[model samples]
Target: MILVIDALNKHRFGGILDEMYKLRARVFRDRMGWDVMVRNGREIDLFDQLDPAYIVALDGSYNVVGCNRMLQTTGPHMLSDVFQDILCGEPPLRSATVWENTRFCIDSERLKRPGADRTVSYAACELMAGIAEYAFNSGISDVISVVDPAMDRILKRCDNAPYGYIGKTVQMGKTKALAALSDITEERIARIRAFAGITGEIFLEDDVVADALAESTPVTMPVALRDYCDAQIAGACTDSEREAALALQRELAGMYRSQPSCDA
Candidate 1:
């Protein structure tokens, strides 16, 4: 199935959120045994109310499938509120220039359906691509995702680790580990598509938007924040800090290039 990607305004998102909660309850609570709260067959979190999120993936009839919740680092996120131990100790929470990519999970029952692979992969790729576009356009410098260690291996093999990994491996479950990524890359994206057996181009189709998304335009940042990032990248900071800066910069650049205008 060809996956569709659409940005929902806050009003439209209410429905998506409802669907996502049901899906999450099914996958995490009933299936995976996550010990999460489920009410009327729906799972939710306090952060759900506080964070601005995007829903990804769809079922055969075009219902929501796999979904990932995201929040800017300006707000409390995974590294800050939940997975602080996952960071290998480089200020697990960045003050700025970062976004927390969280709540990435797939609905397995939905996955068992025909053509589910393409739908899931397309949704994942589309969401990542769209996030990259939004980040660059919004002047955000980086996007961060904390994932399981096994998945991190897959991601590293795919060459998607261009942004860098600052988090350490922590047990989410037996055979489940959590790690973090600074950004997404073309090579990594191509690998993920291949892994899911998806074949086709998924770049955005608009040149103006692509250019704005891809290029490193001077965005407004506080002088101290900008200098700190530069200094960290230049090795004036600790090794971990340098790594964080490098990852953040790479993520920002890759996202910028993934825009439709930069596709050429």
Candidate 2:
């Protein structure tokens, strides 16, 4: 499932964005050997301070399997500021209709396991489709990105090729980088959906689905804990004693709820 997480609605996701940062740390630092800042196993940078929107891809269990960030071009973005060297003296493109895409990555190790197909990782393609849909709906027409050669090729293969390029392809970290432009159109979205075998909307639509799922799903708490709580409530002599037992049960349930949905 795809989630559009931003500063305003981030509180609803419960550390999902932190999981995305951990994924970025593994992909950019361990896998790609990028010079990035990773504190407590999470990768974060100045661009994140700009309050960019994140496209987070989660598995059936809500594990963060893929992710990307979108920032408007009128402000400081990766391509315009951090990757200014790629522009090679040319000024970065800034327009209201255009946005910047960065940190596009998928958890290939997780995808290679049982439920996912390695050759055509649907999570990656799903992210692309999510970007197209979210951008078009948000009034964004195009996006600028500093993509590596491998990602550029993947974009082409997925029928979401960059419409144009700007500046020289310079070496950035362990990979060569070049600025790319991708137009958000219906045909492009349709092509991506076809390639990824997506039949319906991939978006999970904020906390509505999450809240509904929680409400419908049956909770199977440990019988021992349930019995203890029941016995305590039953033996209580005063109303305050009964309230205390109930509060304890609720507190324990809340502890479980606050735990990470799945490890990154």
Candidate 3:
């Protein structure tokens, strides 16, 4: 199950740090060619230490497969410090209760199988839902995300979209789109939590155990179906292989499209 721990540096970091570093290097340095600070086969950065980030997905072997980062607007953040040049003015999340979303990466290489797919999606939903619950309990009402149109769709699918615009997007590397809370709902949160089969006193709105999964941590998929994902990741197997991957990706993309939003 996806665990959402605060100040996770003290604990969860130990379990997924290495895997996260490797995944970052592969995607940022090797694949995407984004300049990164690497030392001794590890990607090190100032943001890692300062940001109150969340690492979301893990495999059965406890390897990290997908993750995202967030920072409060208090200190030097995306608005005043980093991407200011690309921003039109003050960051939308600057004046209110909001968490700045950044560097959301999915280790597609690791997430090639069915197990990986379910785990990644589940983790994302849980993390977003958990954040919403935390915000509600803490008396904070806004969860801000700076993303592109593509990512905005993804967040909406998982149920985190902006209520209004705080700042407009100019140009930040790519066209950046920002979304705020108000879009988070109790019903959507319950649906996502139920799907993930998370059981705990999460300080959330009430819901009940409905099935065998009431008290258990849910796995994204049955073990048997992962073989198909594994085969696809290993490379195209036949005429259908490529078609299958494309179709699956489109399906996943559609999930994001379901909840559309304007700029944050």
TM-score of 1: 0.59
**Prediction RMSDs, each to the true structure:** 16.5, 10.7, 16.1
Candidate 3 worst ten-residue window by lDDT: 204-213
Put down candidate 3 lDDT per residue, 1-264, tens digits, no spaces: 343434522232332444565676776567655556655455545665573655355544445666566667666565556556444664434645656666666676666766554555665665566556655565554555655566667765764545554455544433444543454467656765775676675321112211222223233223233333333422333335435654664454465456455463
lDDT values, one for every candidate: 0.54, 0.80, 0.52
lDDT of 1: 0.54
Ranking by lDDT: 2, 1, 3
lDDT of 2 by residue, 31-138 (tens): 998878886677878787677889988877677899999999999898877888888898989999999998999998888888664333678899999999999999
Expressed as tens digits, the lDDT of each residue in 1-264 for candidate 1 is 222223333332233455677888887667666656676566766566564555355543445667776676777776777766776666665645677776666666676676664454455555455455455555666667766654455445543453566657665543444646554445445555665455654433333322332233444233344334444443322335435765775665566446655234
Candidate 2 Cα outliers beyond 4 Å, as residue runs? 116-120, 212-264
TM-score of 3: 0.58
| Candidate 2: residue pairs that collide | none
**Where does candidate 1 stray beyond 4 Å?**
1-8, 88-90, 115-123, 157-159, 173-177, 184-264
True lDDT of residue 235, candidate 2: 41
